[model samples]
Target: MTRTSLRGVIAAIVTPATPGLDPDAPRFLRHARQLLAEGADGLNVLGTTGEATSFSLDQRRGLMEAAAAGLPRDRLMVGTGAAATRDAVELTRHAGDCGFAGALVLPPFYYKGVGTEGILRYFDAIAEGSAASGIPLYLYNFPALSGVPYTEDLVSALVARFGGRIAGLKDSSGDIGYARRIAALPGGLDVFPSSEAVLDQARAGGPFAGCISATVNVSARHAAAALHGGDDAALQRATAIRALFDGKPLVPWLKQAVAARMGDPGYGPVLPPFVPPDPAAVATLVTELEKIDKAPARP
Candidate 1:
């Protein structure tokens, strides 16, 4: 299977859960299709927003397989990062087998202070194991949650050693400067900053490949408009929607908004370690989002 460079507004989509919480495939596909139709250039399945780490290897693979079979393969990038090297390799290989465009991988998060060498070795194993599959690997750099930041030297080292196999990096650190430095690297690595706010820069043919955002789940239309058309109004609206989740639990808020909009309450329950947002809060969020959607563009 051939892979292409994934760019534009990629939604870090939410996974719909069954009563058993085992990934409702039908609901999952429906949501995915809707997001693409709504203007997401691609879907990042099982990423942070999708609660990837909460699910088992089998569960992740199952959802991936279902998505590949149902959705357009070239537009899907699945999160295959695991605390275990073997598990990460397996999930990544399965992603390649399912014909996903790329695998978004996080560094080993369970052990803190392993240093860059340890992280390099972890990615080395992933590259060596999944080499036969030939799936491009996009490094996921969310240091706050993982406690292991991929420093500049570490990123350069990985790119130098792995070359094109090390495809890109997603900087959810919310630091655009760091992301820009990675994007300016000698190699043609696609650096995706994790915010819709950068869409204008990306649309202007700047260093950023595009954005990989959780909020794109709700604001795909505005994101696409901003990214492709230089629509400042749309950009402002997308940024506003994202800002509303500040300091609150993001997953629950996203899930609640998705459930309320999609009219599927199954999307409401989050995996443990994340409690559902208050109904009042969700109502307020939905109301504000509606206003953003309806409000006229700035004069």
Candidate 2:
């Protein structure tokens, strides 16, 4: 099988929503263009940063379609994972049909205590169902949200079983040790760290293909430079920017920054169960982020 490379910065883009709580397709298209122009090599839409779980099936499909219409297929990877096997398969198939480069598959996450066999079976079923079209699959190993970690053994088995169909793994574990272990695997699977803090190490040949950071939605150019430069100063600046969202709700804080940059007041409102930050919190965060933004990028 020919080896597939996933080297470069891939932004986990936020799906912009209008004041009416509908996804703002035009805004998303503009964001995609901006990210590409700012030096992002690829876009990962519908991931956690995109509030994927909150979206209805129709909404998710619409987002994917809009992205496909706006960006080149090779530059887009849509998150298609769902708690249900059929839903994941259907979404993955849809991504392929819409011409996305690949589908980022989260393990079946709803059922806690699910055995490794169960998780493997879920992916196997989706892969088998998607076999005819040969849609590329990237494993999204975010144990924090999914509560199901993708162990090395499991990844190895899946890669061996899926062969060229399994494209890579996106490790959001936030544990550099685990990321290093995944990178050390023999097949040269594309390993993406979820945080920009590891870019220096990753750039120094640590097996990290690139980053798919939530913060990159707003700071794509800075994140891209950090990945390419691989210097401590660059990583520190990126980390400091991410630090702004540390104590607050990540999504809301991110939305606030994005809104401030784009001058869209509607961007601050999150969907149900994720209320916007209190006014005081938003004020403080805005001030802090403004300072960070104005600071020079490290040499």
Best by TM-score: 1
Specify the highest-lDDT model's number.
1
> Clashing pairs in model 1?
none
User: Relative to the true structure, how large is the alpha-carbon lDDT of every model?
Assistant: 0.90, 0.81
lDDT of 2 by residue, 105-166 (tens): 99988888877678778988898777776888999999999998899988888888777788
Give candidate 2's error at residue 275 in angstroms: 0.6
Candidates in order, TM-scores: namely: 0.97, 0.94
Q: Where is model 2 more than 4 Å wrong at Cα?
A: 1-5, 230-232, 297-299
Report the C-alpha lDDT of model 1 over 1-299, residue by residue, as the tens digit.
12365999999999988878798889889989999998899999999999999988899999999999999999999999999999998999899989999999999999998877798888888888888878999999999999998888889888888888888889999888899888888776888999999998887668887899999989999999899878899999999999988898899899999998799888888888888888997899899988997889777
Residue pairs in clash, model 2: none
**Cα lDDT for residue 122, candidate 2:** 92
